[model samples]
Target: MKVRKPRLKAVDFFCGGGGMSYGMLEAGINVLAGIDYEPNCKQTYEHNITGAQFIKADVFELQEQELEDKLNLTKNDDNLILIGCSPCQFWSIINTDKTKSTKSANLLIEFTRFVKHFNPGYVVVENVPGVLRQKKESGLEDFIIWLKENDYKVHFEVHNVAEYGVPQSRKRFTLIANRVTDESIDLIKSVERKVTVRDVLGQVNGFPEIKDGHKDKTDFLHTVASISEVNKKRLKKVAKDGGDRLGFANDTELQLACFEGKDNSFKDTFGRLWWDKPSPTITTKFFSISNGRFVHPDEDRALSLREGATLQSFPKEYKFYGTSTSAIARLIGNAVPPQYAKCIGEAIINNHLNAV
Candidate 1:
């Protein structure tokens, strides 16, 4: 029997829906394990990303020793990469219900605990912009300091997803730490220019019109209340092709959402997309045209789950869970766009290969 070489294996923590892992896999890195507290993702993660193992475990409960045994990874496994994109609902601006807890913010400290135990050669983290506001005395900052103190060369940036080929304008704080590096490398610099929504969605065909309360053949469509009779009539009056509400609204029905007062609320809403331009960020509620400027810009209905996922840079074949509108939306919105992840993962693999 021949002894095989060690594979570049990664363990994804808080790996909701496997977005990051899929990106890494695209870059030729082997993702062996995905760990998340959400038990719902187990089947989808396993089914879609074949050969990958989904471990539905809370990172907080396990001792690092236990994880080491389960992963069959020892302290000497220097090729290991630990990725943690912990839930950011606490810090997300969209999650404005103040009652939501900040318990997830401390997950970085848990990440640090794993670092101390395994001392993996590489670590990656992604989170919302608000996570930076955490006090210096808090675990967030301490984790940053801990990386420096431990001699890992860290590269972090709040990068926009569009910059890395994800058609959506999602931005995230991405950090890559390498224990083997003595000098810092620019992760952000190597990434190319932004990709637009049109870039990703233009080629996908076979999507049919989805109306509120009606399911498509795939059962992935979302239902928004049918456009009000008045709005429907108004939509009809507007000139075809990406026309905004302004084209048809009279002064009486012109009242805008409080947030969009004075500004043109109809720019993306009830609007058609320009083939040449990029798309706005795809939120979980992307199925609802009223939620943002997600209306097909041409079609009367909003984008379907597949369209939304495509705009978010997920490959056409990716499958998401949940029957409710909110469940599928959360999965798509929360995922790290696979294309963006692949770009970063590719760079990491190249660097690692050169180093090894």
Candidate 2:
């Protein structure tokens, strides 16, 4: 008789739109429960990740026993994985020019509470590159020491999303902490080739020529820019097929806030993307011309929601909530690229299966 492999179980915290869960599920691990504060996320999460329990609650307010009971978890299980990607805006270097808020950083301490109580077999966290620089009342030195004290074989590194087959030049901080310490605990493995915009956006069977702010039959659309008449003329002058503002700039309005009086400073802002290369980071307001290289390569408007999702490595069939441009953009922008999450999940499962 053939023996069946035991399934690894996971619970996702702050599971916005179920991107991480999608990857884990694809890797054949069972994602049993997802917790988040937003109620709207529950609808989108359930719609995408079938057969998973959704709990809408502030994680800090819930006790460990209450959480375990809610998920029907028992102390005997050593296969439980606790994943948390707390909000990164507060710790983000982009916000460094302004006052740094400590409110979101407190969520890490809350995550620690569950880690202590449940003593999960494994833990995973994904955040911006700036998370490594965050300090609190206990300080950064104490923070590292505290995790070590918990006896976790924590592996962490900063990696680009493009390196892991996502068609975006996005960098993130990833950490995998496991209680079992062997050769299997290593997280840094071979890097895949960079995924390009052409690779992801090529050949969808039905939908084509997505316009900005135009929702499909599914009612999902990307945010559209509110370009002024003057800027509109300039954008037209910048040429199509990976054209940028430098092509049209003569003298006036040539100085960008960041560039001012520099030369050889090339980055795509108010620019069209090359169909071949990987896209720039998809920010919260990716539809704006000033945000990044968000302009459509061929169209006058920015990318549609489906285009953004495709670039973010989400499968074409994945559904999103809210017809409003900002609402849908927020859902997509906040999600982990499913492809990268799948890679991590696959590595975790492979290690566990080999161990047993």
**lDDT (Cα, tens digit) per residue for candidate 1, span 183-290:** 454455433665655455533554555554455445344334356666566556555445666665454564345524444533555555544556777777777656
Clashes of each: 5, 1
Query: In terms of TM-score, how similar is model 1 to the real structure?
Result: 0.86
lDDT of 2 by residue, 151-176 (tens): 76677778887877788888888878
- Where does candidate 1 stray beyond 4 Å? 1-5, 135-138, 183-185, 188-193, 202-214, 219-250, 254-274
By lDDT, the best candidate is 2
What is the Cα-based lDDT of residue 320 in candidate 1? 74
Residue 179 error, candidate 1, Å:
1.0
| Model 2 per-residue lDDT at 272 | 87
